[model samples]
Target: MRKMPLRELAERAGASPSFVSQLERGRTSASIGMLRRIAGALGLTVADLFTEENEVGHRVLPRAHRPELPTGPGARKYLVSQRPLRNVEVYVGEFDPGASTGDEPYAHGDSQEIFVVLGGRVTLWLGDQDEARSYELAAGDSIEYRTSVPHRVANAAEEPAEVMWIIAPPTPD
Candidate 1:
């Protein structure tokens, strides 16, 4: 893969270059949601950050063995059942207090994503931002929408929130 310029990536991810440099040098770690946005800007899934390049088969991925990263100040993320060349991808997102997916919504190709709230509460903004319908979800709640439609995710409560996302046709590009 061609490497993206750090400054360019920082701009695209809405992060400061100094912060991105620190992250690259292991001096700091961005939340999983933040990392996801950076990856998305680079045409990759957050899972891509921790993905192994070796060819492998479908095997059980123990929680302890799963790769994790921070998304923002108070968020974390995990890649579950990651098959680099497969057609499906699974992700786990943990948000603390004010943590969120991002400030803007994004759309992609022909695909749908399933969002399941496993703990705490979260809000989903579906459709155009101006006229988006807000869907508040609590533990055990689930919702699905097409990737072609713009959408966003955010924590809806003061407590921490955990959610799982199943993406079809694999994750982003």
Candidate 2:
């Protein structure tokens, strides 16, 4: 391993020294691009930062260890990955019957979102308030939409709906 100082590493990554230091201390966040640059400077990949090296860098995340993401009574979600993924986020959501993410559609920043209905059923609405369309989703069904256009998810079935949502850039608008 190399013993490079923060300033040197930051310079190599084309990032500010303070920014790199803050990132290392977990006091701030960095975009995927910046993280990639830093990783490249260190002769590593972005995934390397999140690798759980129990058996030589396996990224596997067991159910018990997945972090829970707080939500309203409508849904219960678990962040299905360890922290520090600058590029993407994966969440498993258990939505109760008649529950929804919200009554209205919302848009995040320009990013792509994909949803998979793992169990039960759900109604996915895509588009803004002025113009929108809803699609029915059954178990094993999947859909992708532009988050920038605004969207919402709801469980209209009698049973709970389980879904896996993957978003790029890791930002929810």
Best TM-score goes to which candidate?
A: 2
lDDT of 2 by residue, 57-167 (tens): 447888888888667677988988455544577889999999888888878755678999999999999988678899999999999976687888899899999999888
Could you tell me how far off, in angstroms, the CA of residue 75 lies in candidate 2 after the best superposition? 0.9
Worst 10 residues of 2 by lDDT: 49-58
lDDT of each: 0.80, 0.80
Q: Which stretches of candidate 1 lie over 4 Å from their true place?
A: 1-58
If scored against the real structure, what TM-score would every candidate get? 0.62, 0.64
- Residue range with the least summed lDDT across 10 consecutive positions in model 1: 81-90
Q: lDDT tens digits, residues 1-173, model 1? A: 42457997788788999999999899998998889878876556678778776556668889888888556667788988644535577889899988887788877754778989999999999998899999999999999988888988889688999999888765344
Show pairs that collide, candidate 1: 31-70, 31-71, 31-72, 32-70, 32-71, 33-71, 34-71, 87-170
Report RMSD (Å) for each prediction in the order shown. Answer: 10.4, 8.5
Per-model clash counts, in order, read 8, 2
